[model samples]
Target: MSRHAFFIAGDRVVHVANPCGAGFQYQAQSHVLSPRAQVGPQQHEAAETVLVVQQGALELMVNGAAGYVPAGSFVRIPAKTWFAYRNVGDVAAFVLCRTAPPQPARGARKITIQIAAA
Candidate 1:
């Protein structure tokens, strides 16, 4: 049996059973954010990301629609879509994010948002 365990605390960390495993499946990972920390407007180019709020509350803005993702709430960001997330709560926010078949062009570019008068 393969031993896969690690400490996941304030300073969140993740340990894969097989670091060099080859597959095209999404993996669930835990993440912790400090107050006011944010991530956004990123495109995977190949993989899709889904964020699930586990402990605290988070402000999620996807494709111009805003929603509050609290514990038990989930948000899915399609591959190559514009999206962002922010922790607006008083305390740190805990979230579980899953990604599929790592994108080859990960972080190579960002999605631009433009606003026009209606």
Candidate 2:
């Protein structure tokens, strides 16, 4: 059997696999925030991402609008868009992040044609 690898806390690692042309599939490590732990403006050029809160409440600012994303809530971010989020409560905040192609089939078209008797 092959042994897979994993990391422990304090390592500040990013998991990666299956390199694409210019970028590899990447996942940032999950983090736990203390009361008022915060993150600032950040942007990405790759896939769109979502933040799902698992515990406690979180305040988020995307582009410029402000909103609260609490436990069991998800906030979506468009690719290449600037955004930021922070924990605003007095409890530990947990979040799960996922990235995927936005509008994967937007450029494709669908059509239907009718046949007439001559």
Candidate 3:
């Protein structure tokens, strides 16, 4: 049996899954955020990401307009488009993230990713 590998990066918990060895085209991870926390502005050059919210609420900003994403809903973020999110509710947000055309793993170095003030 194989154990699931995961790590924390900045404010997000990243769950690493098998895509290459499992022969899947997309890579998958589960991410969690505390109330009022956010993640953003990064683009996936290789794949279009799909985010499914399993718990709490998310305020997703794409192209400068923010939309509310509720729990049990899914959103498709296109490749290379800059997007950001915020958890507006008072509960922890549980989200499932998947990227097609799975890119290589990111560096393990601890780094803070912040979007410039607009």
Candidate 4:
């Protein structure tokens, strides 16, 4: 088995690359969101987040702004910017998420913030 080749298990979210797993400087993950499913309105304290839409569409709310990202498109969320995403299409959506500088070994610190209802 090559260190460069790895398989992600079938899960809602799977870490494909990480310092502990792939010795990467950044962390990469795969997310599968069912129709109408949604993620967090949270922000990373230090790492920047980049999301790539592989299939279906997503409605994104970032720092009080709303945007529609279609398949093949991507969005960047700077550190400390609150963001959330939902699958807008009537199918499963696939997303590839990358976070640079990776997260702290103890995990990211979750902060409480109010996001306007979308």
Per-model TM values vs. the true structure: 0.64, 0.62, 0.67, 0.68
Give lDDT tens digits, candidate 2, residues 47-114: 78777676888889888988988787778898898888888988899766665566544544443434
Segments of candidate 1 deviating more than 4 angstroms: 1-19, 25-27, 101-118
Question: Regarding lDDT, does 1 or 3 come out ahead?
Answer: 3
Output the lDDT of residue 85, model 4: 97
Tell me the lDDT of model 3 at 93: 94
How do the residues 1-118 of candidate 3 rate in per-residue lDDT, one tens digit apiece?
Answer: 2323334443444555663655445666777889998898678787888887878999999878889999888899888778888899998998877677544345423335544433
Q: What is the full ranking by TM-score, best candidate first? A: 4, 3, 1, 2
Task: Indicate the worst ten consecutive residues by lDDT in candidate 4.
Answer: 1-10
Where in model 3 is the C-alpha error above 4 Å?
1-17, 102-118
Q: Tell me the lDDT of candidate 1.
A: 0.68
Q: What is the C-alpha RMSD of each candidate to the true structure, in Å?
A: 14.1, 13.2, 13.2, 12.8
| Per-residue alpha-carbon lDDT of candidate 1 for residues 5-64, written as tens digits (9 for 90 to 100) | 232333344455533344324456677888889987676776788776868899888778
Residue 4, model 2: Cα distance from true site in angstroms? 12
Q: Considering TM-score, which of the candidate structures 1 and 4 is the better prediction for this target?
A: 4
Where does the lowest 10-residue lDDT sum fall in candidate 2? 1-10
* lDDT digits (tens) for residues 1-118 of candidate 4: 1112122233223333244644444566778999999999888887898888878999999988899999888788888889999999999998887777545445445444433433
